[model samples]
Target: MTEPATRVIVVTVFVIGALTGCSRRDRGQREVIQNKGSDTLVNVAQAWAEKYKEVDPTVAVAVTGGGSGTGISALL
Candidate 1:
């Protein structure tokens, strides 16, 4: 496949893995996954969050865009 398609596939797989890993917890309580990153990825992140909901309705994915620096700082 083309480079762009490959990149998309890789990212999709990574996101799915992350969401699934985070979802593995108490099913009785609602869980929220915070995804914060580049502004350019805001739309893509939101799309992933929406799709992930179908996979696990008990978990809510919250996405916010504030650039790479801000995203990294949040990890600290």
Candidate 2:
């Protein structure tokens, strides 16, 4: 093929490949859910967060425990 034709084909292929491989995730909409709860419930909360993230990678779940008051404050 001619150099011009070859270059056009190469450019087209590259553009198509790049577009197809791109992921459309809205970083601005990404959120991290922070939870603070009783130490006993902390494990359960963490497990729920992990499962949630598996289904929604854009949502981050973080869990911390400092007692009942802390849990309530976290929600507020």
lDDT per model vs. reference = 0.91, 0.88
Return the TM-score for each candidate structure.
0.63, 0.57
Error of 1 at 59 (Å): 0.5
Q: Which stretches of candidate 2 lie over 4 Å from their true place?
A: 1-29
CA RMSD of each candidate after superposition: 11.0, 13.9
Task: Compute the lDDT for candidate 1.
Answer: 0.91
lDDT of 2 at 59: 89
The true-versus-predicted C-alpha distance at residue 22 of model 2, in Å, is 27
By TM-score, how accurate is candidate 2? 0.57
**Model 1, 1-76: lDDT tens per residue?**
9999999999999999988856555657788899987999999999999999999988899999999997999899
